[model samples]
Structure formats: structure tokens, C-alpha cells
Target: MATTTERVKESLLGVEEDLNMSQPNRSSFMQHAIKDEQTGEEYLNEQGFINAIAPEGEDYHKIKRDQYSILFNVADRNHKGRVTLPDWSVFNNLLAKPDAEYEIAFRLFADPTTGQVDFNTFKEIYARNKTSDTIPFNWDSDWASLYLGGKKHRHSMTYPQFAQMLRGLQGERVRQAFLHFDRNGDGYIDPDDFQRIIQETASHKLSDHLLTNLPTLCNITPGSKISYANVRAFQNVIREMDLVEMILKNAINKSSDGKITRVDFLNEAARVTRFSLFTPMEADILFHFASLDQPSGRLGIADFARVLDASWHSTAGLVDQGVSGPSEKPVVSSKTFLHDILVSVHHFALGSIAGAFGAFMVYPIDLVKTRMQNQRSARVGQLLYKNSWDCATKVVRNEGVRGLYSGVLPQLVGVAPEKAIKLTVNDLVRGKFTDPKTGNIALSAELLAGGAAGGCQVVFTNPLEIVKIRLQVQGEALKAAAREGEQVTKRSALWIVRHLGLVGLYKGAS
Candidate 1:
């Protein structure tokens, strides 16, 4: 009266109890008890038996049926029991080949009516292709001609060829995409098609500037239709954009978390662009500007998409300007050389201007400090001035404000060349000391270069400092002499130099 499963469960109960008891002889007993009746051979291997059935009461067949149903439903999409071309295409796109080859495989097995395929048949074909070493068709000869077209008629890619060109693409899928976009079927895609593509693919709304410039980016005249070549070029651009996004995502999403923290984003941005197109600082600035809306300190897919879209628009603009081209390096010539020289000269001139301005602004303070330090009183209160502020105020009151800026002109004139020489010499020396093999300067070399720059600038700056100090202290000296009933005359920098000779100009040289 016992069912077959019940009998089996009762028989295995002893073995299960023995296993729980950690019996050493259970394996031997199981081997003897579970032998094939006719052949006297073991019916199940250790691993096979353990994996084949569930715990004592469960039905293995039911579990297997449930698993099969899950896989079938996932592939079937509509729960229609049979898989369609779209269903198979989605499944195939998840595979390694996912291209023209998969299309061929689909065509070979697909049923025309209802676009339905048996799940078993699909699995058989997939398994065969997965194990097969050789493809049935020749890749380089007749197949290329059949799918990719011959040289004379190679204006556009066939469905198979387009699928082959793109990884994880299928012929049916590509046909549907092309048909959806090529509205009039005139064999050309226009700006409207491009706008739709951008909307669907990037989920980004095209700006007015981007819309107006779309024709140029697609390499077509205004109001003209985009050719297959144009679409292919745009495909390359989109691929590059996607690659950049993927790289950023992988770099920032190190923990496999769906979101990236602000700190992680910055560090990864710096690391990835450290030696590439952008410097670390430039990359950080770009990310900051790109991620302004991400207040939660975490970046998700939408944030990354926005950043990538902005970057792609900029790149497209560069392409339109002829600054960048597909697979072509920008040509460098004498114009480029001249441009480099102009940029360097402009930077040097700006540095000189900045140094002159800075010297002018701080000259009054320097005048005060110099006058206070030059005083020779033993007690601080007995000095010519109480402090730097007192000295500045007294100079303005006594010398009608022009006294504090007495030697500023000479200081300004010297600062420009002095700063230029210091910066230029430091750069030149650092360049000279750089290791040819490594292209890096050692710490000691950098320090030595800095010292060399300081030593070089002293030749120009020391005389300026001496003149500035002398000019600043002159007012105080005159006042002191006047208080002592001795007259003193103001002397100009030119007169002082003439009276003291060439050695006097270099008085503070040591």
C-alpha cells in the first residue's frame, strides 16, 4: 500500500540517521544497498546522488520542472511557451558572439510562423554552437561578400554586417532599430532621427545648441539626410562615450555598490586621468562641474550619464571644428610651433606683470619695516617710531604720504625681471636635471634648482632692496638731523649711485 517515494524515503531514513551519527561505514553500506539489481554496479556516484535529490520528503521531478519553467518564462517574455526572434535576440545579446554569427544561428533554427521557437530546439542549437570549434561558413571570403557586401556596392552595411560590426547586436534587432529611425525609408536618417536616437539612447534632452549643430556633427549639410557612413561615424562616437562612462563607473564603483561616494569619485577621477588627456586637477574640476546636482555625495547611473552626455557634446563640437577626427592625429606644423612660443611669452609677460603689481602694493609696508629695523635705539620706545604702523603713520604725516612710496618705481622695475629670471631659471634648471629615462626630477635636484634660481635672482634683486631701504630711511634721517639742529638734504637714487660709485650700488651684495 506504500507509495514508491514513501518506500524510498523509509529505506534512506537509516542511512540519513547514520550520516547524522558520523558513521565511518555509511558509504560502504550505501554502496551495497543502492546497487543496480541486474548489473550489481552502484546506481549513483557520491556527488551525483547528493545533488540529484533534495532532502528526504521533497519531489526531485517537481523541483526540476519548476526550474525549467522559470528559465522558459524568462526567455519567453510573454509566457507564450514558445520563444520568438525578439526573445532569442535578447538572450543571444547576453552571449559573447551576439553578432552576425548569432543571427545566422537564429535563422537556421527559427520557425517563420508567429516567430516562435521551441525552447528545447533553441537549447540544442545553443549547446552545439557553444561546443563547436569551427564555424560552417568561411569568414573572410564568400561570407563577407554575402553579409558585408563587395567593394563596388559597399555604401551601407547589411543587417548581418551591421550586427557583426557591433558587439552584442542581432540582425533582427538592428533591422527594427533602423526601420524605427529611417522614417521615409529613403535610405537616409535625418536630424529628427538623430534627436530620437539621442533621446532614446542617452535619455538626455538635446539642447538648442546641440540640435542646431547636429548636422555638422553627423557630417551632413543643413537639412540634408545622414548617410550610413555618417551613422557609422556617430556609432563610433557613441561607443567611445559609452566606454568612458563604463571606465568612470568601474573606477568609482570599486565596492560593486550601485552608488559612488564623492570622495571615491574624486580619487578615481584623479587616478584614471592622471597621465591621460586631462591632468588630475583638470579631471577633478570637470567632475565637480558635472556633478553639481549630486548633493547626497553619491553618484548613480543617471549622474554618470549626464556627465558622459556633456563630455560627448563637447567632443562632437571639437569634431565639427576639425580639432579632432576619427582615427587621425591632429597635424602639427610651424603654426603650432609659433602658437607654443606665443603662449610661453604670454605666460612670462603675465608673471612679470603680477610681480610688478605685487611689489607696488606692498612697497609702503616694506618702507615701514625697513625704517623701523634700520633704527639704532637700545630701547624700543626710544626708536624713531613705535612700530611698523607708527612708522608708516609718521612717514605719511611728515613726508606728505609720497615719502612711503619713495623707491617704489625702482623696486617695481627690478621686480619684473627678478621674478621672471627666478621662475625661468628654476624651470630651466629643473628641466636640465630631469632624468632622461624617467622624465622626473629628483627631490635633491629640485632643491638645488630652487637654490640656483635664488642665487641668480640675487644679482638683480639685491641692488633694488639696497635702494629701497636707503630711500625709506632717508626721511627719518632728515627728521633726526633737523631735530639735532643739523640740516640734511634729500638725495635721489641717481645722485646716490653717482656719489657712491658702482660698488655702492652693490653695497648689500654680501
Candidate 2:
């Protein structure tokens, strides 16, 4: 029955008084301590402040009351006795409107609720606030800044930090992120400007010594804007540089005369990076590199850098001169080759075992293959056979149980060689074609090797495959036909071998 303005004003006053009384060692005049006439001990007393105030329990009630006031008001822009779509632009508080302004806007417009707001209506309330604001939200400032800017959040905020922040703001994280990163005063963040800002902030924080070394460290060409990749590359360098600077900062704090020496750098780098300097494969790869006539331990950072720089130059990309001078191509060291062989043997054994296991488990695929190959055409076979179980049952009913394992003998022999060869070749090709020095395998090489392996698999297995197909196709038709009808003689593997010869077996190959 109260007007929207009157109720809001009264609610606000009640809210203010509640907050005041809730403060430690604080109370309103009406909520002031009352003297016991006998003991003079001041006991707090006020029904209006205690009962009328909106405690956390009454929060939903207050919000509902607010919404009801809006709905009842004739001044409300939205018609149909509730907040609606067009009213969202004008109404500052969407929760007070009949239609949802934020997330509920879609739902409200869609369902046109016969129901009202509840405790879960928190999202609706927040949405009203969000849609009302004209400016887009920013994340890096409001959200990421809390963690990334401080020592607490700087090193890294884990999944918990992400969850807590998301829950605290409800689901406004994306809106907040967009608004914070919209640095240009524009509503949207363009990729270029976003990248530049990150780079500038990162570069700005480099230690003084590193900053002094920048002129020499920079491989930039004059008058050229850096690409996003180059910017990231520079950031990587800065991160490493910052690690070195952190040691100096520690030394400065300790007031030690000694700088972080090469020994110190290696020890610290190993500690921080926990560099498992030699994974068995990497060690083997490195040993291979060391075995070359050039005689290096392995591909160092510098050697790797050279390969990358050359790649960049060839691609007509912004090239870093720091990487370009001279370098030897890394070779497979003997130790590395031995390691590779050991690994290859282990994986070959494992893959063969797995393939053999799967062969027994899903041997039905072989049955399906046989039926399909035996058919005059794919569609006829598929329609006639129905499902896999039906085909199996039909095969047994017509021929016998041996029909299920038509190609099994060749398949058993094929599994080991096929799996072993395929896996071993895949590893070798991936290692070989990938520039060991640069760690980038050429895309074309990957495609070529993959296609070649697939083709070889089919080629090597074709003869056995043809035998299996012939066995699966056999039935009582030829037996009956031979006895009386004499339409077509049933063909056996040997019969086909004698009549059509080896070429005849590979009928499906073409």
C-alpha cells in the first residue's frame, strides 16, 4: 500500500539504523541502553530497531518488497503490471522491474514469469545493477589486479583464488574483466592494444641492470612495430632476465659483496626450475647431440635460439639478431641413440600387447570387415546383415562357429608387426623431422610422415587381409549349388589361389 519512493526512503532509513546498531559498542538512541531502576545496569532495548531492521534473514523479503512496489506503481514504464523488455533501458534497478534486466532479461522475456523473485533471486538483483551501468566491465583492473598486482597474487593465484573471486561477485567476472581491460575508454578491447598494454607493463618493471642491458639485448629493427609473437618472445626473455634480477635483489637485501656467479645461477636455476636436466629421452637426444664431431654437451639455449631465428627470417618475420650468428646442427649422440632404441623397444612391446588385447576384446570388428568385403556392394551387405550380432549369428547358422574367426590367423600374426612398426616409425619420424635444435617440427613433414605410415600399414597387411575376406564370404550357397543347381562353384582360399592366382585375392584393393 506504501508508495515506491516512500517505502524506499523508509527501508533505507531502517537499513542505516540497523548498520549503526550492529557496529561494535554502538547503538541508536531508541536502541540505547536502558537503566534497570534497581541495579543501574544499562541493558539494550528497542523493538523498532530490532524487529523493523532488515537482518540477513529479511534480505529476500526487503528485495521482494522493493519489486512489489515497482510492480504496483502506475509510474513504472513497463506495462502488464511488471517490468518488461523495453523498460530495462530506463529502469536503473532491474530487480525492481517485472522483466529481468541482466540474465533474467532473457528468461523474463522468454517465460514472462507467473512466479516471483526468491532467495536465488540474487542473480536477478545483480543483473539489474549490471545492465543499468552503461560502461563495459574490466577484469584485469578489478579482477586480475587483486591477485597479479600484489605479492600475494603476483607469483600465481591458484584455482581457489579463481573460485572465491567468482563466487564473491556471483557471475560478474566476465563483465568486470571486459570493463577493466577496456583501457581505451572504448567499450571493447581490441587485441592489438590489449597486447601492447601487457608488454608495456611487463617491460616497465624490468630491473635497472636489465634495463641498462636492453639496448644490447634488443634485436629490434628501427621503425617497426612488434608483432604479438615478438612481444611474447620479448616477454619470455624478460621473465628470464627478471629471475636473474631477483637474485640481485636478494643479494642487495642481504648486503653481500658477491654477485650471483655462474655457479650460483646454475644452482638457483636448477632449484627454481627444478630442471629435470635429463629426462631419459631428452638425455638420449642430448647424448646424440654431444656425439657429433662438434662435441657439445647438448643443444644449449643459444643453439636452440639460432634455429628459431633462422626459421623466423625464412618466414619473413621479425628476426632477432641475438639468435643469428653461428651454430652447429645437433646430431643424435650414441648414448641418445641407445636410449631411443631402448624406449622404442619398450613402447613396441607395450603397443603390441595392447593391440593383441584389443584384438581379442573387439574381434567383432574383423567379423564385420569380412562380411562387408564379401558382399557384392556395401549397401547390400549392410542392409542384409543388419546388426553385428545378427551377422555373427547368420554366419554360424549357415557355415559354423569357425566363421567368426575367418581372418583370425593372419590377424594374430599381423598385430605385433603392425603395432610395433607403426609406433616405432611414428616416434622416429616425429623426432627426425622435428628440428631438434629448434624444437619445431615442420608442419609439412608431420603430414607427409603420417600419410606415409598409413599407406604402408595397408600395403604390408593387404595379402593377409584378402585371405581373411575370402574366408568370411564362404557359405552353404556354393555347397548346395555344386550338388545340384551348379550356378557358381564355391571358392576356397586355395581354389581362388589356383584359379585367380595371387592378384585375384586382392579384389577389393582397386
Per-candidate TM-score against the hidden true structure: 0.40, 0.33
Clashes of 1: 0
lDDT of each: 0.52, 0.43
- List model 2 lDDT by residue over 389-422, tens digit each: 7777777786677767765665666675677667
TM-score of 1: 0.40
Please give the lDDT score at residue 480 for candidate 2: 43
Cα RMSD for candidates in order? 23.5, 26.7
Q: Model 2 residue 339 lDDT?
A: 88
Model 2, which residues run further than 4 Å from truth?
1-332, 335-344, 372-387, 398-402, 475-502, 505-510
Q: Relative to the unseen true structure, what is the C-alpha lDDT of residue 155 in candidate 2, on a scale of 0 to 100?
A: 38
Model 1 C-alpha lDDT per residue in residues 1-510, reported as the tens digit of each score: 977555433322211221121122233224323445676644333332332211233433212322323233333434444443343333223222224234434444443332334334544654564434321222234434554456465333323434444343322233345556676887677666655554444333232333334544333234467665454544443444554565567765574766675456546645766444333333333344345555555566655554454322322222122212111222222245577566557656876898899998988888888887887553456766778788788888999788878888888888987887788777767866875423457899999989998998888888777776777788788887877799788988877767777688787676
lDDT of 1: 0.52
Error of 2 at 362 (Å): 2.3
Native-to-model Cα distance after best TM-score fit, residue 193 in candidate 1, in Å: 39
Pick out the ten consecutive residues of candidate 1 with the lowest summed lDDT: 13-22
